[model samples]
Target: MDTSFLDSLSDSDFDLDLHLIMGKKSSQKKFATMLDSDDTDSMSSSTSSMRLDNMTENGLSEVQVGKDDLLDQCLDALYEKRGSTREKALASIIESFNSSLQNEFVETKFATLLQQCLNSIKKGSAKEVALASHAIGLLAVTVGPGEKAQEILEESLSPISDALRIRPETSKILSLLQCLAVITFVGGEDPEQTEKSMHIMWQVARPKLGANVAAFKPSPAVIAMMVSSWSFLLTTVNGWALNPKSWQESILYFSTLLDKDDRALRIAAGEALALIFEIGNLDKFCGENKDSSEPTIDEGKDSRKLMYLHGLRTKILGQVRGLSAEAGGKGSAKKDLNSQRNTFRDILDFLEDGYTPETSMKIGGDPLNTSSWTQLIQLNFLKHFLGGGFVKHMQENQFLHDVFGFTPKKKLLSGTEQRMSGSEKRMYKSPNSALSKARTQLLNKQRTLAQGRNAGHFAVDE
Candidate 1:
């Protein structure tokens, strides 16, 4: 397996049509191209946001370059005729931005530089475009999630709107979508900016997502991006329910995801919905839940909110029923149609049980939903995993070196198939995570073996 992610993307332009990327079949292949930008960067700053860039800095910046000189270097490298040189330059600037984000001069120069990168996205080959898209995300985070960055990002988005709206191929679309997600998150620090970015994303991304995508079949990469983007919106927005239009659209889109047979898409959609209930302050409308972490309508509920929730619930439930209709005989299609039967049922059950005392008891008896807790646990684990300690250990261990190179990153499925039907089944850990844990376990085994051998040697000497 070629671990040279950028080299692979740079090698050729993958002009993949929707048919080529229609289902899970081509999804893995297409995503292989999209795999280059995960927690990699030359330097560090916004790992809390974009979590990428960590490439070798050798010869990238031979001498210590000043902030202005660094920006000049980035632009110069980006404009280089050679793809490798250009990518190296872009990676350098991204690293600088990450480590010294608060520097005013760097922020100013980098902001302009980032816009250039966005504009350049349309100019390059598949690999070039992906790298350019990546630079926009990395540089945008460098601008920080302040009020200033928001305006700059908004300005940059307009220039790229047509590309997003017209709908490009899978590789290009993946890059653009990731750019949207990383910039919006800004390492999850600025709530206001995140909200605005979410709206901007919805505006640009809505028509191209879920029920209304490239064609009758949605792009897996695009769908997966929506799952993440939408979840962030619900989880972070202060008044998420205030935007009636977006709220309605989110429902249709999320319901569309919840209906997916792909485990990841379903979980992303489900968790987004769950977050809405938990933090959307739905209790103001529906009341409170005594048992679960989510709010309930145990007290006097607001009729308007209840009516609104009921409306959304009704729409979702209708979708589930339509799915239950099943297309005649038993086959893949039929199985896929009703695959999310239990998931949708649980969502509805959670909705009903939130307020119904008796249903609450029954729901409590059911297997605990560990889905909601995943993000928090993963966040802490990431902090620990990315900590100095973890990296040092990885550096010391030989097998761990290559193993820690990547991290497990799961996304929603593309092209419609409903295999991951349950909430528990819907989400998956990163394969990189499994590998990391395996290496650690192996290291422990080695330690035990060494200890035993030393004891035996000592016994023999005695």
Candidate 2:
């Protein structure tokens, strides 16, 4: 095994997200306090300065300006003839997006931003194309599961496909794969739409070219990415709606990937298989399409399919058992080895005991929980895809809130906001505050009644 390739596997696992272009994180505070508040125009100047300071630290010092203005500048830059200029503009836009939710900006400029990004995909350099891909994905996330999301999917598919046809660099391919997964996950209104995107992704891993066309075999990294991205979109699809024969073939194909030398490829295949089993329609995925009331076309054919599925399951179980206890090989990355072991172990546990993995995490004072592989995969994929903005969306994005069934306790307060004094805190219930006014009126009416009963009774006269 090539050590460099093995090392690449370790780094490529979750590198599909925007962390590549966003660069290293500097100590930064979120600027958008209005995320929790209704008034968008009420951000204090001090907090605005803090936001600018963070962006300056990220090397956007010269472009320190209001969010809308910065976005406008980026939009204008996208139209510039230079690829480097467009790349910087796309990077700035991605930074702005990952730092905060740009709902208002997206609402007004959604089409324009998307069209520009797609143009970049069609014309820009590989780096620019990757950045453009990341920007569009963030756009889908910001819009989040509605008409706008669907429109994004519709518009992005063609240009992205055209880009993929050229077989760009590994980074560009990874970015485009993730972008496809994200847009489809949010915008795919039905299973068919989701499956269409999956088909596009799957072709990268298993391409079929004409006799004269040069064959483009995917490296392990690309294959792993294809599997991971395909599985991410798979979580949104309904198993019943899938083609039975195709999935059975997929099961066979993924099982083969488990034996590959790349640890990341094995881990991704393991997760994909685990999700398939978790869906628990083995009969459907194994090529049995007849309803219970319908007569069997051929008993022998059905039986053979069942037997074939059982053999595949048994083979996979044995393979998973070996991987769960795999010893580290020479030249193998310890981290990658352990990750493979852990993942396969989880898959083995689920296959044998019928128990899915459960996990929990804090998302802005709210518990985002997942008790199944499907939910966990969805959560982790989106987290990596959103990167810094995960918390922002998890906290304030209603679409995500609905998807995850998460409701935050309260909006997060900014660092610049001052703590209230005891008297000021009490004033929230002191009848002067707007929230307490109605309750105060009710209390005043009650006080009037109570005074009559106790009138002149201070000395026990009553």
Candidate 3:
């Protein structure tokens, strides 16, 4: 099958209508295109607040009824007999989610929403599966890290893994890969759980051969997405916690991908390699894992391990150097070539000078900084996966703020909102202030402890 069709696709291919919010569907383009910038025409909170003050009791009740009915209708639509109906319902759910963080909705209907999405993945068409996968990701994000988040992971992982076991369309594969990365990011609190997720992604890209299972080859697009999603999860893992044999083979495998015909695959592999190098536990990658029954390594083995590390680094550095200066070929995309060149150049600089590139971006006018490859990969992956919702989550989702160490500037009240009493004002901002600071600190501490364990300081010998 010609998989090149995937290369021509973009987020706009998934554009959905928003008329469902008004109890009907229209041909007009309503939802923001996926993987694109936030629309400037987004409804303003200040404007909505003012409108609320003017609404009569009946009008306000009608508005509430509209929202409640829309959600109920979408949820019910999931159970409809037609695939298109289920797809539209999933799309409407996606629009409502991207427009706002559905904290209260998830709190009340987490299990039902999750199970419905999972059912779609198991039985719906390719498009339906894609949308359902995306909705599941959003559900996990809204729930954040807690028992509920863990439950999402536990309930969804098997169904997602099962769906991926069969060959699917490029969009479906992309969605499932992204969904796996996201749920694990939010819910897989332990390194083992995270590693388990990574392993699942690996198997999808390169399934193990068995007597009944023929050797399966994934498309370049699938391979690229797998590498990216795999690297996204790698950002949270500590270097020392990784299996020596697995990552040793991974570094070598990625180096080979650098020579692939596909530019996207090359770029994805380059980024993954750069992240591995940035993590920096080369000795561990080279050394043989000593079992309890076996004696410790002797001097000869130690010298061999050191030699292997040096040779591996040299090979990877050569590949990076070559890619950094690669010339454009016949029929090559100038944009893709430039992207590959820029990525490799950054990797080259880091490998040679130990200078990881620093990135800064604005979230609601506040800066979010990432000074390492890991953070940068995590940020980029999440931004791409979140699509138009990225900005909304950055502004309002405390989970995201904590993950990126971002603090969106507090907005001054305007219109009718300014008329609130001092106590009301304090109460309004308290959730964004006090609880936020405490959760941020707690998350930071948990990450620190996780890193310490990854360092092998707290790990027991296997």
**lDDT against true structure, model 1:** 0.46
Indicate which candidate wins on TM-score. Answer: 3
> What overall lDDT goes with each candidate model?
0.46, 0.71, 0.71
**Model 2 spans with C-alpha error above 4 angstroms:** 1-64, 287-296, 411-462
Residue-level lDDT tens digits of model 3 in 369-448: 88667777878888987777889988877677667777666533332355665446421121233443464455445444
Hey, what RMSD does candidate 1 come out at?
Answer: 21.8
Deviation in angstroms for 251 in model 2? 0.5
lDDT, residue 201, candidate 3: 96
For model 3 the TM-score comes to: 0.76
Question: Residue-pair clashes per candidate, as listed?
Answer: 26, 0, 0
What is the lDDT for 14 in model 1? Answer: 53
Instruction: Give candidate 1 misplaced runs (Cα > 4 Å).
Output: 1-72, 81-84, 95-108, 185-200, 203-217, 281-462
Estimate the TM-score of every prediction. Answer: 0.47, 0.74, 0.76
Query: Tens digits of per-residue lDDT for model 1 on 1-462?
Result: 768875676423454544445543333322222223333333222222222222323222333445555556456556555554555455455545444432455445655676567656756555556667666765543344445445555655654555666556666666666676655544333455555556655654455456655543446556766556655444334443344333434554676675665654665565455445434334332322323334467654455545555666666656544543435353455454354454445445444333201111111122111223123222322233223333322222222222223221111131123354544343222224344355434533442333333222111111
How does model 2 score by TM-score?
0.74
